[model samples]
Target: MSVNIMLYKITLVVYIAATILFLIDVLLRRTSLGNYARGTLLIGLLVHTATLATRYAEVGQTPVANLHEALSFFAWMLIGSYLLIDLRYRLDSLGVMVCPLAVIMLLAGGVIFYEVPHQNPMLDSWWFPVHVTLAFAGYAVFTLAFLVGIMYLLQERMLKTKSFSGLYYRLPSLDILDIINYRCLSFGFPLMTMAIITGAVWANQAWGGYWRWDPKETSALVTWFLYAALLHGRLNVGWRGRRAAIVAIIGFIFLIFSLFGVNLMLSDEHSFDAFKSLR
Candidate 1:
């Protein structure tokens, strides 16, 4: 009924249209549909931007205060990152996977309209949005890498097993996938590092200490270390192909645990209150 929800619905409709175009392109081998899908998705992103902006204006602060907000924001980050990567690589095939994932995230978030009574004063600072944006951006980049990794492995398996299929033809080459995975790693590490640094600074301001042994903090650190090791091996030790893809996939799992497992199943400063508590 509200303008924010209405804009969100419009964004979802646009995303679904783009996704349908992409699926048709994949199924019917219509190259023009891919370009149309990209344009449609870009429009959807603009609408999504409006949705978030309206929500922030309505809330008088950052909009990511609950599951509904966080999921929507995460979906936005994911789609934005995918678009950025696709821009560089011209990866039309990836849209098939990413668009559906974005739709699912939006739908799941839409299903839960949990809202808090009052905004947490800790989230009043600019650091809340900055840190969360950087962290979610990092998560988005790694997710793309993981998706590409899966594609790489699947392609490799098909080649080895000599079981050619339509999906194999649709997916990018293993080399391209691996190169993009490395690029994602290179981009995401810095974002994750910045997120941690900003989080520490914010923590110092809010909690009177930079380092807390809280569950979220510890899990983020662990996930960061995992990425660090992966990057180190990649740059210096020359890990590539199956090794890199497999490890990157594992890293994504760790990231999921760090981002969701700690916040949802476990309790901490970043538990999200399941969209509860102004205290």
Candidate 2:
């Protein structure tokens, strides 16, 4: 096997180990288990970073042109985001959601759609990395918000029914989850805005027009508007709790469809095949 593949497999193992530890910690509320999980996830992120770096060395450009590369990088960024959030919130419970998603992303990227690196001139632009980095970072933050949204809803329900479960015990209070949801929206909005702006610039350079109204573009625009409205509601009207959580979940679902579905299932200018057709 190649060095990249070797490292990816190792990282996947580490991520799985971390996820299991996190799950155990969630069930037991043991600080030691949470610490081990966090440490293991840190090691996995380092190894995954090496994998991306090595892929870049092998391929002459950023390693985000294909599903495997993009998903792996997405998982890497999610782990990084989770770590940063952990530094402040001590959100050990968040790991139960984040780590499993990371593991699934790594598995889907590495196993289902592994592709050999091929130089694509379309991805040669400096804008490619900049746009993708911002886009994925924004998505990572939104995913966190989405998970926190779920937690908020669960906590709310448990409180209303007065039937608290073990998972309920592990979850943060509704107030904290709502705060996290708003904070994530606050951070993700700007990154997503810049992603769209840089994307327009890149699209203008690559395509003949600034807007193609392609499926990806349309979905991105809609997703942008969705979050914009959510933020607007929070800032202007003071929307929070259940309403905010629901919107977050809806927005992320649309975002994922834009990211994966449009690329693989639907034809769009963003797809590799479409890129080749343009050339």
Candidate 3:
């Protein structure tokens, strides 16, 4: 636990430094500093992983069964996705957006460290880990796609308006953003499907039903349907650019509402009591 705390402190510090460096790099147009920011981000990711591993070993289970663990996992997923995309593409500008988000998520996770000793009874099954992990992984990818879509729209708008501001210059081309958005969604969609299937199976085992209209479950279904529509529109309608980008943005908004808003605003078996305590 002491080691985990130290790792958490290190992650928080590195994430803050990375965010500052990325922001400065963007403002000053320093690509070299952006490389330094990426290295800082890598350090943060390593420390965060070590902390989670330690927690898992201490707990004798995957730590994600509790609110604090889930929130930590969410932060890790964000950084992990960013690292993968950054390695694959020259998306340093994206780090300027994502690094701050990672910092916020990690800090929030740290602040909400109230210990809920017992796991939720509903989440006691073997598939729980697979379901939750895949769901969060899919969410992470969608989050990246959402940010890229935003950049695409902004760049396209700037082009149409003939405004060549610093942001316009800093962002990638709309075409490139569109391609990145599609690639992220393509990778995320299959993982989301697997999550849904595993979740349904877990539901059947725990609740004697496969599909309860619980708020969380319903919201997830709606988000899934929205993304499925986006995918279909892209495939059947040959929607490959700005239009597809818009759909991705909408899908991500719905995903956030489903993941956070629904759990806070409504009641359901999947609601894990983090709502009342803000943990």
Candidate 4:
């Protein structure tokens, strides 16, 4: 096995270990285990970074044109974003939610898809990487927001019912989770907007049109509008707490469909095979 493949496997193993540790930390109330989980997560991130860099060196392009690379990159961005948030918020328990997601993404990327390196000239444009990176970064943050929203709903329910368990105590307060959700939306929305604009420009340059109304493009626009409305409601209508969380969760669902379902199931110019044909 090549070093890149080995690194990827190691990263996946580490991520799995980290996820288990995070779960144990949350369920068992082992505060000390949280520190170990964080350290393990950091190691996995470094290894995954190395794996991507190696693949990029070998492929001579951004390593995200294929499903394998795209999923791996998305997982990497998600973990990186979560670490940053944990650093700022000290919400180690959030790892219980995030680490498993990272593991699943990595597994989907590294295991489900056969790893083959091919260069597509259609992705040769400078804008392609920028567009994809910003778009996935936005997705990552929105994912974090969605997880926090779920936690908020659970915590709210526990509070209302007076069910106060260890899980309730371990999770951050509803207010804190809401603030994090809003912040994620604030960061992700502008990135998504820029991604759409860049995507249009790239599309026009490559395909001779700015707006194709392709399924992927249309779904992306719809996802964008969902978040836009969420933000608008938050700022103008003073939507917060449960309402904002619900909207954020709903927006993320649309985002998943835009990213995966449209690309895989729908016929569109944005599909991976279509890019090869364009080349």
Candidate 5:
């Protein structure tokens, strides 16, 4: 096997170890173990970055356009974003939620990456990278927001019922979690918009049309509209607390479906060519 494959395996092992450690840390409420988990996660991220760097060096371009490559990028962005938020908010429990998702994405990469050809042809312009990068980053942020929103709702429900469960004690305050969710969405929505615009431009360049109503395209549009409606409902329709939280959860479900579901069933450019095994 190649050195990159070896490094990739090492990274996956480290990530799985870190995830187990972090889960145990959270279950035991051990701050020291949480710190250990962070250290392990950092090491895993470093190894992951090196793996990607080697792949890019071999390919001689950004690896954001293809389905498997995009999945790998999304996993990396999730780790990076989680670390950033955890640093800012001291939300160690968030890692327990995030690391598993990243691992799944990375494992999925192991399956799909092989089906992808070794030689990635340039798309004739740099806008392809710009568009995909922004979209995946936006999706990453929204996913974080959605997780926080779920946590916020759970914490709030516990408080309302006066039940001090272990999960409630481990999670952050509802106010703080909601603020984090809102802030992430605030940043992510605009990035999603830029992605859409860049995509329209790229589409016009390649396909001679801007709006093709493809499965991935339409699903993304619906996801965007849902989030936009949530924003409007929160601002003007006086929807807050549970209602807003529900909207976020539903929006995220749709987004996930758009991300993986469409790719699995639909035959779009964004769909994975090797997705048969993914099912």
Candidate 6:
């Protein structure tokens, strides 16, 4: 009914259309359609950005206080990151993998329309937006890394078997994918680290403690360590290709648990229902 909601729906439809175009391009080996897919994706990104801007205008805060908002913001970050990568690397084929992910996140957001009350004082803190934005941005890039890792494995398998299917020809080279994976890790790791540090500072400011060892916090730490080890292995032990890909995949799994699983399954300061009084 509202303009923001209408824009959100339009963005979702555009994303779905873009995803279909990308899928067809990949499956039919029609590389010429790549431009059309990218154009559609850009349209969706623009619409989605407008939707977020409208929501922020209404709320006067980061539009991520509830699950729906969080998911939508995460999806936006994912698509934005993918577009940057596509621009830099000319990897339009990756859109086939990424567009569907954005669609799913948007769909999940659409499923839950109950607006969370904005009375929580945490929304007033300057650190809230910074922390959540950086954290989800990190998650978004890590997700891209995960998808690239999967593609790397599939491409590697095809090469090993010497089977040159359409997929084999369509996907980028393992070297290119590996480079993307490492670059994503390099970008995401620091964001995650800063998120944790900001989170701790916010927590201490709000709850009078720097470390509560909440389930969400612990899981976040685990995720950080997983990526840290991967980075260490890459820089020191020369982990590359399959080893690096596997680590990235596994790290993303842990990240999913940290982001959604902990919030859903455990009661913590971070849980949606567990808001604390600023007093």
| Superposed model 4: Cα runs more than 4 Å off | 274-279
Q: Mind giving the per-residue lDDT tens digits that candidate 3 earns over 1-279? A: 577777878888999999999988888987779889999999989999998888876766667765567778888998899899889786888998988897887788778764644655666678888898999999999999999988988889899999888898899878789878888889889989899999999888997898988888888888899889888888788887788888899999988888778777876666645665554
Runs in model 2 deviating more than 4 A are 272-279
Cα lDDT tens digits for candidate 2, 28-138: 767688889999999999999999988887777888887778889899999999898888888888988999999999988876445555676777899999999999999
Model 2 sits at a Cα RMSD from the real structure of: 2.4
Q: What's the lDDT for all of these models?
A: 0.88, 0.88, 0.84, 0.88, 0.81, 0.90
Residue pairs that clash (backbone atoms under 3 angstroms), model 2: none
Name the regions of candidate 3 deviating beyond 4 angstroms. Answer: 114-116, 277-279
Cα misplacement distance, residue 170 of candidate 6 (Å): 1.3
Ten-residue region with minimum lDDT total, candidate 3: 114-123
TM-score of each: 0.96, 0.95, 0.94, 0.95, 0.91, 0.95
Candidate 3 residue pairs in backbone clash? none
lDDT of 1 by residue, 2-48 (tens): 89999999999999999999999987879778889999999999999
lDDT of 5 by residue, 106-220 (tens): 8977766633344434365677779878988888888898888888888888999998888987998877787787777778889888999999898888888998999989999
- Candidate 4, residues 31-97, lDDT tens digits: the string is 7899899999999999999999998877788888777788899999999999999898978778888
How much lDDT does candidate 5 score? Answer: 0.81
Task: List the RMSD of every prediction in angstroms.
Answer: 1.9, 2.4, 1.7, 2.4, 2.2, 2.9
Q: Clashes in model 5: which pairs?
A: none
The clash numbers for all candidates, in the given order, read: 0, 0, 0, 0, 0, 0
